[model samples]
Target: MARAHRYTVEVTWTGNTGTGTSGYRDFSRDHEVRGDGKPVLPGSSDPAFRGDPGRYNPEELLVAALSQCHLLWFLHLAATAGVVVTGYTDRPEGTMTENADGAGEFTEVVLRPAVTVADPGMVDAVPGLHERAHQMCFIARSVNFPVHHQPSTSAADSAV
Candidate 1:
């Protein structure tokens, strides 16, 4: 049997100056993203495209989605496998290449996850979990580019 899931969001542009899009740099690249019952997400273009560095950009959001999706799926798998996960963190990176025509695309994304587990016996098992996560992560499966993983793990009692 097949099932379908739908996700929706609203993005409101808030960058209109006195004159909207009158010039190449007239408006801010600011916006608000909203989902039902969720806090409004502040968003903008990448700073390289004349956006505010303090705000969240689409590129960064994509990377965050990938990281979060993998973490969630990994946790689920660990629970089923008795891995006893205690902590997890990921510092993800992406590469976007822009042509002279102002068109761009993400070439790759690297997920660097450091995990902590309750059992040192689980350390050897942690490495293979990333491959399973990639197979299960919706974000990773949806992206056109390859998503690479580099994971490190340690027992909760030991320092990485």
Candidate 2:
């Protein structure tokens, strides 16, 4: 939380076709995405769209960032609480629904994270750890959405 940075990406496109002929426009982030060729969407007629699938999508990146942030915070909290966490993994799923305001736009995203915590005595700490992680995660606190984390433990609850 010491400092943060801000970045902006501008996407612009231009197309020129006959009055009847179909026209297409291309888009690019401020900086070019590294790949086999210029980064363009696959659905488009452009065959040179070779950017990595996960890198070009902003929504995908947001979900990943939140999930990773939560995991890191959870690990730190567990360690401080004298919990021996051998490993952990989280699969965060995001759903993008239409904006409820009827503005023809998308609205808040829903994050459903399923975290697996591996530790002999850490099972009982899942609930508290999750709450702490949510509270401490910078990404979670920065955004306004329902980030639901459903945690699962490999050990029994009595182990802790």
Candidate 3:
């Protein structure tokens, strides 16, 4: 088998909650990010010091990674099966609950995918496709949390 792909990122902290010193990390981007300020991304209206919003949070990123991975796999499978997937969108929600140590953790996550398939019967394969996607999803397999998919859809108007 061929070697798997790899990725790398570096983060740095500058302040502590004790002295009220604000901190920022370099995502290798031109700008910096702060945990206590508003998100730096354009249109990010967070009250925190111009931070980029919650999308940059670790837990949220994990959920998004899983959702994106599943979508990619589903699209690949659909293409191979001669199914035309026109549009795809999903709202993946991650729930944070208290763990045994009294710390909050993402105990559950739900992925609601709205897929447009060419054939109406293709909707029935959503469950199976999701299962297979989950099996191949690297992020889902790496976490201990329970991830569920609540899928709904409409028929694709035309094949592209």
Top lDDT model: 1
Rank by lDDT, highest first.
Answer: 1, 3, 2
TM-score for predicted model 3 compared with the true structure? 0.68
**At residue 160, what lDDT does model 3 achieve?**
23
Q: Assess every candidate by TM-score.
A: 0.97, 0.59, 0.68
Q: Pick the candidate with the highest TM-score.
A: 1
For model 3, what is the C-alpha lDDT against the true structure? 0.68
Looking at model 2, residue 91 earns an lDDT score of 70
Estimate the TM-score for candidate 2: 0.59
Clashing pairs in model 2? none
Poorest stretch of ten by lDDT in candidate 3: 41-50
Which tens-of-lDDT digit does each residue in 111-156 have in candidate 3? 8888898788777776677778888887888889998898776785
* lDDT (C-alpha, whole model) for all candidates: 0.92, 0.59, 0.68
lDDT of 2 by residue, 1-160 (tens): 6786775543432222333224323332222323344564322111233333433355666778888898788889888987767656667777665455723322344434444445555567768988988999888888766787666666533322
Write one digit per residue (lDDT tens) for candidate 1, span 41-61. Answer: 999999999998888999999
